[model samples]
Target: MIETMGDQLPAADIESFLPLRRCSILSYGVGHMLNDITSACWFTYLLLFLTDIGLTPRDASIVMLSGQVADGFMTVFAGELIDRFGRFKLWHAGGSVLVAISFSSVFGGCLLCQILGINSAALRTIGYSIFAAIFNVGWAATQVSHMAMVNCMTLNDTSRVALASCRNAFTMVANLTLYGIALAVFSINDAKTSVDIEDQYRWIAYVSILIGCCFVGIFLFGTKEPRLKQQHCENNQRVSWAYWFSKLLYYQVALVYMLTRLVTNVSQALLAFYVINDLEMAQSSKALIPALIYICSFAVSIILQEIKWNGWRLKAFYTTGAILWIFSGVGIFLLPSKIHNFMYLLSITTGVANALMTVTGISMESMLVGKDLNGCAFVYGSLSFLDKVSCGLALYLLESYQSSPSSEGCHDITSCQSVTRYGSGLIPAACALVGAVVTYTMNLHDTTPKSLSEPLLA
Candidate 1:
């Protein structure tokens, strides 16, 4: 009887919880570094790699969209399973293994064609699409598991925010690492032919895999599965998806999260194109400009760690980011190739804006889940579902028109009407304006978004 009573005691002992140590936060934060780095490569370079290797712009976009669609489909299912079974570590490990292997295949080129000794464009597209889809499946699993762990980590709101900031900082680190790798790969090897370009991307992919896997190992070794009290979670598994869908806040969050993702991802997808084909800058600018963005983003993420966060503060920071993107987007559209150096300034602001939106945007998931704990994975999955589909469709549509003539009758990047420039500038700016308006409409507070508890860590 006493043992049973003691077991029950833990369920009631809420206030006794202390903050998560910085080491724990840091360890957990680095777990997703693998996902972040791979995702950065996918968005920033996949189109360029595909186009450079002889795939049409339409075909390249199709490959990217296929991965996004696969990822979107996987997130909700992954979330459902994680919420039901509760082995976050297992899911994370399995997903990491998938990401490492399949991601390499996506960038490594058409193994199917190489084996069969055929050079069909359709065959290559299909081969790349298969690997891209597989990679995203693993990516979805890793992402959902890692993110859902935040709710189980602690009960303190401040610590939750700190954890998020730490995670964002690591994201910057991952981007910097990716660009650093690319710069070296591109610099040391001049690609005089299509085959050479493909080889450079393959090498970059291999190096990124090596670096990302080490961080995943650190995460698995340093962090233990949180002792989520069985009593609290026992009933949570049964929480219906409909319960989440019934709330108005769910829709608001879904829309805003989707918009945020579109803004970030779409901008990234178009950047390599803008810098190379449009701006006609040196090959090195491709890596250097993105490096500058992540450096500034990393600094801002560190400073965000020191803030005392709340609901309104989260919204404010997010809106500030959106507005910044608006200005950057417009600047990107208007800047002619003659002033290409000005892009460095825009990269700085873009990085800061990215950090602000990304950190707060992710935190809102925790807020929406509150103390519900039940099917929290589903909540994340559903949000990601929307994000993935929206981004995929947006990228597909924009890239489809890359070869179409501009209405203004301009022939080159200097005309400021190329699809690359238009997609890079106007798309994100439009999304940000809409996201800001939606953010203001949200009704949020410190307690579990709906009721009572620390707003952040638990």
Candidate 2:
């Protein structure tokens, strides 16, 4: 085991990063950061847009839920196609083009509705649903290809962690910066005229398309694949779906990675609802806090991995994130409705936990996946899909209580608020706690030095 470890580790720790055979690695990360920013911008703004476009509670829910369905199906195919074809750049470019097209289509549809005076809720619902599905599908495909390429960038554990952390940090910055920009522009315009809401949104869509184009171009021109021989055998050389699926599922570390992501994403969804409804923060404020939290968390995670908690990095991530999450949940529950300051404090703590988990999860995944398999995208996409599903479930549970016909009177508001609070805070904390427990219980760190054979999938 020790020898295997030695073999994998570069002679110098600095040399562990991908040797620059091509500029693709750097470009891949850059593309991801750009795409992430664009996506976050849309996520932040889209909900409000639906409300603006006359979508009722039911219509908005239908649109998001339907997108989740499409997300699940697309991920399976995206993973398979990337793995079999190995055309990462092509997939990426195509995905970007689709994103531009989808967003434009949505904007056009909304504009058409305004022009024809056909602002019926049903029409808006259909238009939004179609837009949501296509947007997510394109995003998912690009994500798959991008991840596959990232997996090939380097073979070092620490380097991979560093790279993922850097990308995540940039993404967080993008999230925060774009929201700030949106808030500044939207607020100024919002005070001028109510009718210009669609105009403001159309401008946002134009920015989204530009970002998508940047990602597509960055990746298409920047990345170059290095020469690596494919593994071949006498008769079983061709890759099989069963082989990939089994390898992904049965690999010990991959199992751990998958479980952690599910927990992390569930937590993310729950928190989103909590911020908007429970704390009663404005959407822009909620978005800003999360961005800060992510950035701070990302920085702390890198330090923990590299220094203070270096040896037990994963443990630190799990334990710190879990404890903070638990406390954050308690804070949310006990926090007064008007205690916006305390709520943000609690958010900061939750952000730290989330940041740690994000970095650790990426590191663990890079460690688990095969050099040739390109499973990072699959794992990422699958994990991404699961998080969305968990978010949907959390939303369902929260909305069920909020919109329930039975609850009435002043007490009902409290009950509904309680649902929103717990829906965001407790659910994620519980998920993280469970993940920490399961991961720790595995005794993954206790493997005998001699027990390290070549990794099953690696």
Candidate 3:
């Protein structure tokens, strides 16, 4: 049997807990980075691209909403398949290729129209939605498999932390790199305005496809899957859907974590809109703001991991972070337009809050799930499903409100500052407050390793 806090495993099982090879861990990190880069490239620019190309904001939002819904459902299926097959590498490789093709197709369709001198808004809208759905299918599959592999790769807590840190570091790097590329490619004449650039978008698609394929090849060829014991495989096979649902319903920490994730996604989806159209910041500022945020977040995460914490400390960290997030939102809304230094400060503060929330939230999730559970992928998938659905709805509502005729006069940066402020600031602040309240009510004392060993229904 596996060891618990007050229980010990036999000597024979000790060998099974060895740390993974460094190269294998690095391969997983690189794969995660590439996946995120592909995701960010489209998500960061798709809405802007559509609007610049003549699609209404509402229509663009609908297209993205549809894709998110499809992705949510696919995650459920992907999780089941991953658990049933015990073959993450196959899913990872296959999903990567599909993601590349679908992602590029989104841009390629528009290019084809331009090349053929066809100017149909309806066709472009439909094409973008279809390709978005296809991309999500691949994204869902790969995300489920990749995250589950983290659990399966090692039972050693320290090794898992190291792996998680590596993934987080790469995430920051990927964000910076993608945003830098977007800035360099899209900013024309330094005018701080949207431009129709089908050629630029097409080139981005080609480059993204090439980069994605190379990283996938590296991951597939570099990493070796860990072997699970027969009893563990049996346990995984025995996990029932009812039990999974029960856990999802009853798990307070997971629900709270999902809420936090939803907040993050909503803010991310609206960020480019707020920065480019509302504040009308310079191109360099657009790229530098987010880059600074990630850098600060990465640094704070490193510090957070080094500190030792018990239940009280964890709660304190979360509470403090929540308060900071709330303040950051308010500050962003109130900050003077075109003030670069103040904006940088605000970005740094937001980044610190992000680091705090993510590190503690993930730690809480791991504690709730524990090492005994064999259906890690399913659990993550369920969370992802809830997160995407909630986020999609939130985005749709916000975009609809902003794109309405009533808001037409407010489109200019000077006139629309309040709308942008609230959309980016007050709304997210409210959500963060709710998350804080939820976190406060959680029974962290009951989340011990012993409690984790109990059945979901019990």
Clashing pairs in 3: none
Candidate 2: minimum summed lDDT over ten consecutive residues — where?
Answer: 226-235
- Give RMSD (Å) of candidate 1 vs. truth: 4.1
Between the candidate structures 1 and 3, which one is better when assessed by lDDT? 1
Per residue, candidate 2 scores C-alpha lDDT tens digits across 1-458 of 44555675544322223233223334555666545755665545554455555565456666766665676667668876666556677777777777777775554445445656897777777767787788778877877676656555554444455556656665665666666666666676662342476677666677656765675576577666522212211222444545546753334444445445544444444445556655566766655666666667656744543421122566666667777777876666656546666766776787777677667666555554534343445665665566555555555455445442222312233544466456556666666677666556433231112323332113
lDDT value for candidate 2?
0.57
CA lDDT scores, all candidates in order = 0.85, 0.57, 0.67
Model 3 scores a TM of 0.84
lDDT by residue for model 1 over 166-242, one digit each (tens)?
A: 99999999999999999999999999888898889889989999999999999999998866524457654467988
Deviation (Å) of 361 in candidate 1:
0.7
- Candidate 1, which ten residues in sequence have the lowest lDDT sum? 448-457
A best-first ranking of the candidates according to their TM-score comes to: 1, 3, 2
Which candidate leads the pack in TM-score? 1
Backbone clashes in model 2, listed as residue pairs:
24-223, 270-424
| TM-score, structure 1 vs. true | 0.93
Candidates 2 and 3 compared by lDDT, better number: 3
